[model samples]
Target: MLPPILRLLATPLPLPLVQGMAQASLTHILREHPGLFDRLGTFAARPIAISPTDAPFDFTLVLARRSVRVTRRGATPPAYATRICGPIVLLLALAEGRLDGDAEFFGRHISIEGDMETALALRNAAESIPLDFVRDLAPPWRWAQRPGQAVLGAVRRSLLEREGVPCN
Candidate 1:
């Protein structure tokens, strides 16, 4: 569970800011890996909601259209074919292929609801790509890579520490 202070602070954030951040991040990922959603096969058209159980909002990914929509947790959400609910860190780890989805699922670290096929397709598709979000978000400059990755790594380590996960 996330700290109460974080939930409190995030709960009242402007919707546009949250949605815009999601869009920008999605744009970067798609730019870095074109045709990334094409590997979802028949599940590409299905909307998937990624809910960070410890967060104040959920992200509904419309992979078919290459966009994401953020919805406040307590508000009514649009229809989604599948929902993957977990801690934000675990979700990121899954997308980055740093964590085994099957093991986490079986270990009860994450929960999947709705269409199982869509979830499985997503897992397989994500696993096929090596996503380094830190590098992907950094400016495409040779000199920026190292410092950018270092800063991002430090931020991630702090977040992990806050979640009581040991940093290597």
Candidate 2:
């Protein structure tokens, strides 16, 4: 019931406004984390896209020297994109900066296609940060930040037993 309502509400939002906000957030994140661009420079020229299967969301990430924006459409076909095909909980766990990308991939929760190298770089950049990405979210989301870390810790422990040393 709530899902449909949420979608209906979100569907009416102006794309430009949403993109601007997303860009601002990404820019802020980059500014907060120095050396991130140096690592991401390889893929900065090429657009990065994130496609979430849960909704009609296709965010084409535009990363520049001083700005980043999540555009609604990609200017060109991407060699690779992060496919968020799992439950939204997976994303929450990731935002907390705990869930292992290799674990998620082997666990069949997420996938990156086309340019595997860039995807690897993206993962490295994301995990390099010391702070929880969820911290940047509104107050309402703070509770989940801690639990998300816990959930990822549990997954990490289990993965350690099944598969030694999961990637970040």
Candidate 3:
């Protein structure tokens, strides 16, 4: 049976509300880690976009004055330098070091565009962070991944069947 009506996040939440919460979370993490910014120092003023190939929204992270910030300008600046795109699950795994970056890249599951320096800086930062920060993200992600993909396929089939559309 379909789940009963429940909504954890109402639609049309104010953009600032989400951004502010994200900023706060990052700020809290930085306060705990204390040296992450130094790892990201190379891209201090530059914008680096993180895109999930399956997700509609993308955001850029910028470090300024030793603080990390997220922005959704949606406009790609030449200065934006590095952009990474991958399925949501794999991307999260990549950040968490649960999977090899090279395997994901060569498997064609992830793609990188633009400046190598910014990519390197981001890579180093992801590697330097204590696993506890990202370890929490992977288990739930890995657990739900297969079932989630199946559900998406089922949704597509159900919609197409209703529309008299044949999907081969």
Candidate 4:
């Protein structure tokens, strides 16, 4: 279970606040990792876009908030756009080199729309970066698992263990 303070922190905030945080976080990550953008030419021959969609889990995340729309053809660095329910989750995954373009992240609620090849290439480049360096930048809520899950789990167990006293 999460601490009360952490639970409060996980609550969705305003869109503007989320967008501001996303933009600042993206800028910080890009600035700290110069080689990340420099290596884009290796992946995308054409520009690619990624768009993320917010879901029940994290409402404030603005999908595709940090995107590079125009990029050179045959560029080593890949371009991408993403729509994620949690910007911090996406950022942390990117920084940690754990992003899988073909994985079921979207099916699980992390959406990405773009050129498959370019997206894969970008994923490769992002994976090359040292993830640990960006660990401190991860959002506070990420520090613990979501509280709702625990509550739901308890409810499920209670329902399963109770004796059947009535018919529907």
Alpha-carbon local distance difference test for all models: 0.84, 0.57, 0.59, 0.43
Candidate 2, residues 114-163, lDDT tens digits: the string is 67766677667677666444444322356676776666566445533443
Candidate 4 positional error at 23, Å: 0.9
User: Which tens-of-lDDT digit does each residue in 1-168 have in candidate 1?
Assistant: 666777898888999999998888888887777556768977988999999998989999887788899999988878999999999888887887867888889989899999999999888888787677787777668988889889988767776677555455
Angstrom error of the Cα, residue 7, model 4: value is 9.7
Per residue, candidate 4 scores C-alpha lDDT tens digits across 1-168 of 223453456444554565466556655666666565556664433444333222212212212233333212232334233322223334334446544534536545344554455555566667776644324244436544345445544543343233221111
* Candidate 4 or 1, higher lDDT: 1
- For candidate 1, the per-residue lDDT at 37 reads 71
Provide TM-scores for the models.
0.86, 0.63, 0.61, 0.44
lDDT of 1 at 111: 97
**Candidates ranked, most accurate by TM-score first:** 1, 2, 3, 4
Clashes of 2: 0
> After superposition on all CA atoms, how large is the RMSD of candidate 2?
7.5
Better of 1 and 2 by lDDT: 1
Best by TM-score: 1
Q: What is the lDDT of residue 85 in candidate 3?
A: 82
- lDDT string for model 3 (1-168, tens) is 111121123224555775676666555565666666688785756777777655434656675543333444353433466888876556655665656788778888789998878887777777787633332222246778567656655654554354333433
**Residues forming the 10-long window of minimal summed lDDT in candidate 1:** 159-168
